[model samples]
Target chain A: MPVIGGLHRTLKGKAALFILLLSVIGLGTLAAMFLRTQREMLAEFEAERMQIVEHFVVGTLKPVMLTGHADLMSGIMASLHSAPGVQSLAIVRTNGIEAFTDDATMKKVNDRLGENRFSRILKEPVQIVPAGDPMLKRAVESGKSDFVRRDVAGDGTVTSLMYPIANEEPCHACHGDDHKVRGVLVATFGLSASEAGTLQSMFWFSGIAFVLLLLTAALTYLFIVRIMAGRVSNIVDQVNRIVEEDRFDKRIVIDADDEVGQLAISFNHFISSVEIYRIEEGREKERLEQTVFERTRELREKNDFIESDLKLARRIQQNLMPEKFPTPPEADFHAAYLPCLHIGGDYYDVFEMPNRHVGVFMADASGHGSSAALLVSIVKAIVSTAGKDISSPSYVVQIINNTLAKLTPDDSFVTLFYGVINLANGKMSYSLAGHPPPMVYNRDSGELQYLQTNGSLVGVFDFDRFEDSEYIFQHGDRLLVFTDGLVEAMGEDGKMFGRERLAELFKDARYERPDAMTRHLLDSLASYTGGAALADDVTLLVVDYKKG
Target chain B: MKITMRVAGDVTILDMIGNMKSPADLEDFSGAVNAELDQNHLKLLLNFKDVGFVNSSGLGRLVLAAKKIGDKSGHLKVVNLAPDLDELFTFTRLKEKIGVFKAEDEALRSFQ
Candidate 1:
């Protein structure tokens, strides 16, 4: 179903509708008041016409009746009846007798005579009949002069005036003085043409006024729509354009100091503010981007410098380890070094000492990476210089521990295992400083022995003592010396590659050559740890004695 | 790892929970111990009953922590170690450097 909404949907439509409605209500009220006033004025004019008619009839009839001139009275009444708008004029007797009148009254009197010889013989005898008009009878009985009424009779209005003829002193000559009223002079006047003209004129005037009011309303509606709605709509369109295009630079142009102009001014202020914010935001974004770019460039340069420095440090640490071991005729030596990071703390070296003894050293600093590598470097310098002068392994370890304790920080320490094998006697004397014990595997007996010696962590205390334990290397005996990294390596199940597992591997790989056995140990470790990255540096040194 | 420290008499008891396995865990543990040392709380007792595991790096951190405490002339002790952890301490011979107790009260008394 379609709805008939009022004209308030659009600003222009609503304005025009309000204007038209107000004009119609105002004009309608004014027209109603005008019609009411015109009706009152017409009624007053009709009443005045009745008064004049009554005065004229009473003035003309009173003189004639007092003169006792019935003929002149009858002639005057007959002339009045024939005058314009006059219907009838007659003198009606109070005792049901009508005296005097025009042709219509004479005909009524003749009809009342009805062949009566005495009524015909009387010369100008007054004929009596019952009073028919109630107002005339009332006027005669009351002796009141002015009595009038109006009756509508088929397209005409008949105004009747009753003027009572009182019994004056002159009338006592012919009549008795006891009578209060003698007769009623009744005048019936028709107002068909004049009243019709007045009504017609009133209708024409009202129609013209209504048309003029409609014209005024229409003109007012157009003027209001043009002056107010059009400007307001233009402002609205400008605002919509600004919003739709996101062009905060645009503004509404208002020329008047009206409410709409104030609205446009506020809108322009808001748009200007938005435009300023947008520019500021753009500048902020650019500044942020520039700052990020500069920071990123600086970070890249620093990273490049640090990377090259670390590479150099790694090279130096690698050089600290022995590249070639001194192969004594009694022993064959092979080792594997796996550092978990770029540089590590585990180090091993094989060198010849005095008395044709082969010295083997393996050490692990506290942690991995550059700091640990640096600690190991200090240990390497001390050991390489001190090993030449000190023949006894225990004495050399004691000197290195004391030197490290003085030089290193309190939290930094190294666990070292140093051993020297005398080629002439097949006796290997070793010292352990908080390091994992070395394991010796006998190929002939199929037995494994761990060189377990109690020692405090080196570099932690200057007074810490390391005991030298001697092991006789039998023929076909294989010795494994390694850092704790090897045994402490963890598998996925959180279990370490413990000493038992390493001893088992040592026993199993006793028959292989030294190099092949080291490879076997590493492969076993890889399999145990599921080939994951080693958590620490693993350094293993295997020395196999074929003949001692 | 979560570490909480409380003072009992002259002893600062550090209650440790969770595994100290990753480098971050080791750093957190060492940092906490160092912070306690910085405050001159030398007599430290580490309660490890709730600690599930300690990797090789974590052990190295513990060694470094013990050394740091010792260097400051502070006494550090560990208590309530799990079975594997106890074996690790014995195997690594860290028990020689730091006292290991089976109970918190014993470790605290040892501090005195």
Candidate 2:
């Protein structure tokens, strides 16, 4: 079976069922009560009719029987029997013998008595017993004055009444007064035709009333369902459309001030909120996207400007390095430079000093980028002007340091190694200002030594000092100077290509020419670092003393 | 690089770690030192035990710190220098300008 609760699933169905049920109970009860009243009214009318007939018959017979006029009594009974709806009228003795009867009652007694002697004296006093009707017998035995009963026959209903004549003063003269009941008057009235017709009409009226009531109930149910279900269905349809189309702007159009209208109002409020939220969210997203686009454009423009400027600065820094070294006839100089950034802090220059000597200079400013590049330019200006004024390498360094210490910011300084090669005497003098010691490799002996100098960092303290160290150049000896970037180059495992490794490489590459030696050192560094990006600027300068 | 400062007697010990080679690193160090000086914490001990490297800019910052402290009529010292940094101090002759100590207690006692 399908679910039983679906009977009133729709509003129309529920309304119809409710109206039908209420009407059925109300009309059925009304009909039942009306029918019962009709039945009782008919019964009461029949009883009243029988009682009137009995009184009429008894009133007429009592006077006749008191006057001892049996013939008058018989004529009166015949007239009463001919009255409308009267089936039988008779007077019978207490022993159930008929005393007086109408012609119809006499005929019935004769037919029942069949050749009996009692049937011959129909006109005179006669003893005719209505034995077939036990009600009459019971009335006689009970000695009651009036009794009534009813029986249904094929043709009609019969109401029977038994009225007893009591023994009075006049009756005692005729009958010697031995019993209380002298005789009984019996009257039978037919009620079937009238009652049947009335009941049939009542039934037709009830049926018509019931049909009209049901029709009224059905129409009322339809009207209510149309008003309620129609409005509700409209709201549902609008809501479904809004949901299916994702249209928060739509609203229900119920105009009443009832519950459904209030519901529509609430739904519209919700939809309005949702629409506002959607609009706000869309605007917010657009605003965020616009902001991001603007920010990205600004960043891109700034980056482009910075990149162009850095490239220009890099070119200038590159120009500061010497492209060609002087031919000193005794030594060949070569240098390799790599900057971690677009601009580097490492700078090197080889210029001719007085007395036919060449000044080999390498300096590494702190940090990188434009600031360091600027610092290196200042150093270059100071060194170029001061180097000519000061013949000693240590004095040139001191002058540069004192100038930078006053000019540069406290958080920036330079480490430098400056050396002068006296080409005529084959002697080298150098000063180290807080820079890594330059290494000298003897190609013939395959031994590497560091040119240690007692000096402080430049551009840090005004009173700081620097000292010069001297080394005699020998044939087949190579001098290598580099910034800390060379020794501090880190591998993938975080180990530095330390000074020890550089010394080993310098000793091993002693047979290489100055240019080839610098190239070999860079290659080894690249191999050691596994081609990772350099974290600092690497600058290497190799000077090979070809002859002493 | 992280720089943390703590007080020992009258000395402010600034413990520095990580490489101090970049301009940004030096700026932070200088700013911290200046903040300490502004707070009248003149007696300072720069502890470089965990510091791995100090570039030219970092050395310059140390020198500047010493000079700033001296201008304020106070003393600045250094302690717990890493091997490389200790070598750098000797090469730069920074010990002559600023007292160099091998331990924090020694530096703190010097401040006392």
Candidate 3:
């Protein structure tokens, strides 16, 4: 469907409508042809009636009046009156009975001769007569002759003609009056229009027949089109559904040898092809899956060397942690880290400072594995130098950023939760830079609370300020620090093991020991993954404070 | 496959004269006989006289038609079936579904 000036009209729909309109035009043309033929027939009927009446008027009345004999009309009347074919005939005088010059009319001058039907019509304006009606006043006037109109008779329609009698030389002499005009002869022409009635009947019958034909054609068209459209549309719908849903479980049932049956037969062939395609598709899917499995097994076999390399690297990274925790005594040195992968970029070190405060520094470099480990190594070197007197973790992070800001690529950053706990007074200072804050597991309240002290990612801008926050650690409170890799591990359904799920997973956890707790949490995550491939590294650290 | 049938009053002789690969031919023959039987209320003597094979679709069609005949308060008797066809018919258990006879006369007599 296309919108043209906001009106949606398609060429195919317009073409179909045009075809239907052409059919209607053809039907209308048929009707017009029928009406035209009927009009010709009516005209022919009227002309034939007029011609017959003109024959009588010219052959009988005109000659009689030319002979100047009144007896001539009466003789012709006598012969034509008794004829059964002639319905009625009357000769009316222009003045009175004395004006009837015909001899046959003279014998019954006072008698009502052939005047019964003529005068019986109460409305004298339009009437039916065989030898014309008495209303043919033209027959009395200046010899005007004509057939009357085709009008309603007792049974059907009829026509009449007037045999006009003029006041000629002989008729004028008989009058012998000083006035020029004399009474004229009148001949009634009554033509029962049975032929025209029959013609009219044929016209109406044909019209009705055509109407019936049109109705039948329309009805049959509608019926056949309905059934055919239903069947075809049903097949089309089924085919569409089959294509959409990719199913070939049903077949069309058509028994006839019509086009629709042929279509169904072809459709069955199409369905057979579809069935073959679906089976082939199933086989293809299975083949592809087998190939993928084989390839995966091969890849995993080759990956053993890489895993060993990563394990070696992890041992090297772990060996770098503080050994005995007695560099500067009377301060707690505790940390925990859970890496998502066999290796990760989350590393922390707590060393005793000369000021009796433990220097705790945690860093999460960008990404995982060897690249992140390289950057973490750089950060570790910078921090190990700064850890001597720089107990404020935020300033330490700022100095690391000033050193590494030129090394990072575009959109590359990391987050860290760094804190130095003052074992003397239990005052801890920390800075967070876009990292999930350390979860303080309160043994007193049996709740986990996150401490918020914010800083930006290191290695971003050289002059950026890093805010430092300090708080006193409670004896029973446990702090937990983790990298995003732990919370961002994906499940089979594309959902990440987000912070909320991690919290829920840890809601009833009581490993009691830092190493066991960290190991348990990491093992629980690996189990939740169900041997699925990991896309990110996992790293966490847990810290439990005991009164010194 | 095409089917042939001849109706003689209360007895309708049906010939499954062609390959009934889909059982549709059998069903068509049976349905024709049953329609006549229902319309005329005649006892049906259906002669499976010529059917040589039947497929699942064909067998299904026949089963459904026979069930329809039974629902219409009528009995159908099948006869003149070849041994192979009879084996196929027995596979569908048409004898258990309706009534099967070995001879045409017996099938006709079952109409009583």
Candidate 4:
């Protein structure tokens, strides 16, 4: 959401527009009243001008009847001039031409018009412009003053009064008949005189109205801006501060029934509830972590106990292997045994044959641990009782496989390189079951040949067949037997010493004592792989086929 | 150190009364419940109404009881909490797993 910046004002509904509409309505009503008042005042001013015309014509004619002198025209002009709002006057006698008059310009206008001025200005009264005695025509006919509204001298709009004369007792002497109109007198007044008074009144009214309107606006603004908006904005500012500072713990304290007061109360309540929840959450989290810590400690102690017990059990289990192997009476025997770590399932043993042809066995479990060690122990026990029957290494493996097939888990199996050396003949036959082949170095040809016959690891299938390969050895022949671990030693740089490296190491090697050579070869391998952990068990067996 | 224990029907109601301030007592309480659960899987109600405060270690025992019951497929509910402990439950989202109620009847009826 976009933030509102200037003021923290939140007007929820339609209040602002409502106030604006009210102000315009108030001003419009006031203006209507002022215009109506001005129109009525103008109407009254026009009526007063008509009354002045009636009085001027009636008074002048009454006096002219008594004196019959030209002084009546000057007297009427002077009295009308002294009347308020009056500006000019012109009067003429009963002749067809200019008669007695008081306006100084009348003499000039009389010379200009001659006889036509009186008849033209008073006869029918031009409907368009100012003329003499529209009242004169009325007085001649109905004997009363008449009124007409016009503009004087083609300038501004105004009202004109025409008073006509038709009677005289003294007119019997040389003045002509009393029924013939004597003269017409004209009065001119500026309409702006009345307009000025009205304008002055409007000015006073407008001044007072403006002051009151301004005062009302100022009062409304004060109450709304200072009193109302002020209090509300104060609350809003506090709320804004709370939000900015993340001070949800603080609360607005209010004790009133109004909306803002209620809002303050509700806000306080919400803050308190959330604060309490936060504190509780802190406690709960601490508790859960403590529980986990305690559990970790328990598991550690339990693992330590279980590990020590396994060590003790491994020592007892190792004691069960055959303590000594008998030398074959008519054949030379050589053997090597290696276990990878603390314990493993690699075992080699020589048992005295009932027929005096010894059994030599070398067996490696598929993978080693306590379970495989237990299996090897079982194999040892079964083979100890089958001493006479285990003359051939292949027959021993076959019996072990059948016994272990039921004891092992599905898919578990072992491999063995087992053989029997017959002292009566110069030939020896060996069986290989999924184990690396033994190498025979023929002293005659000075070449090492590997005897490899593929077969499945035992304990997987009882129907699996073992392959036996034979070789006849001459004098000074050397046979080398080893587990796969011999070539798999890791070098100082973490590279494995593979079969090629081992074969290369054995090249052109000659030693007077086969035992010394065996010791020398194993020692050299150890030196080459210093500080590199062995990946598998290192096993070696060397036998010299001496001439009998 | 407060220990409040209630047995209603086959369900055991154990209220961690007062401030569970003593770690030894709390551990013992969790241990005892676990041994009892080992013998007979008793439904549990761990109430916190009178518990004023639980430091980190003391609260740990409650979690122990919860996990013990959870592992054995038995029910453990916490109920009738004072405000502060109630705060702890809500904060940890413990309210989601353990049925939290205001009173004993409410706690037991939750099983139904």
Q: What share of the true interface contacts does each candidate keep?
A: 0.21, 0.69, 0.00, 0.00
lDDT by residue for model 1 over A1-548, one digit each (tens)?
01112222344566567767777777777777776676567556666766677677677778777765566766787777776566677777775556643344445444554532112222354544354657666786678865455645322345666677788887665445766887777677656765656774766588567859777767866876567655666777787788899888888998789887898898889889999999999999999999999999999998887677567657767988897998878889999998775455888999998878888899888765667777788888877888764357888788878887898776567888888888888888888777777888889988888887556667767778777888888998888889877887889897888889999888888778888888999999999999898877899999888776
List DockQ for all candidates: 0.26, 0.45, 0.00, 0.01
lDDT of 2 by residue, A187-239 (tens): 67766666667665767687668767776877776777667666766676787
Global fold similarity of model 2 (TM-score): 0.62
Name the candidate, 3 or 4, with the larger TM-score value: 4
Taking all chains together, the TM-score of candidate 1 against the true structure is 0.62
lDDT values of the candidates? Answer: 0.76, 0.77, 0.61, 0.60
- In order of appearance, the predictions have TM-scores of 0.62, 0.62, 0.36, 0.47
**Could you give the CAPRI-style class of model 3?**
incorrect
Rank ordering of all candidates by DockQ, starting from the highest: 2, 1, 4, 3
- Interface RMSD score of each model: 2.6, 1.7, 34.3, 24.4
lDDT of 4 by residue, A1-548 (tens): 12432332333224455555666667667666666666557557656765755575567556764464445445665676676555555554422234442343234444554532322222332222233434454545565556566643312346655455654656444344546666555555545545655665775578568757855885577456545555566666667777788787887757467877877777778778877888899899999999999999999998777577557546644565457666554445555555555455666676666544556666655444566567667767766776356335667667777887778753345557766665456466677765556777766677877776545456655455655666676666776666656664667875556556665555545443555666666777778889455545566666566654
Off by over 4 Å in 3: A1-181, A191-269, A272-280, A287-314, A327-367, A374-548, B1-112
Which ranges of candidate 4 are over 4 A from the true structure?
A1-252, A255-263, A279-283, A290-294, A305-313, A320-343, A350-358, A387-390, A423-426, A485-497, A508-536, B1-112
- Of the candidates numbered 2 and 4, which has the greater TM-score value? 2
Point out the worst 10-residue segment of candidate 1 chain A by lDDT.
A1-10
Task: Using TM-score as the measure, name the better of candidate 1 and candidate 4.
Answer: 1
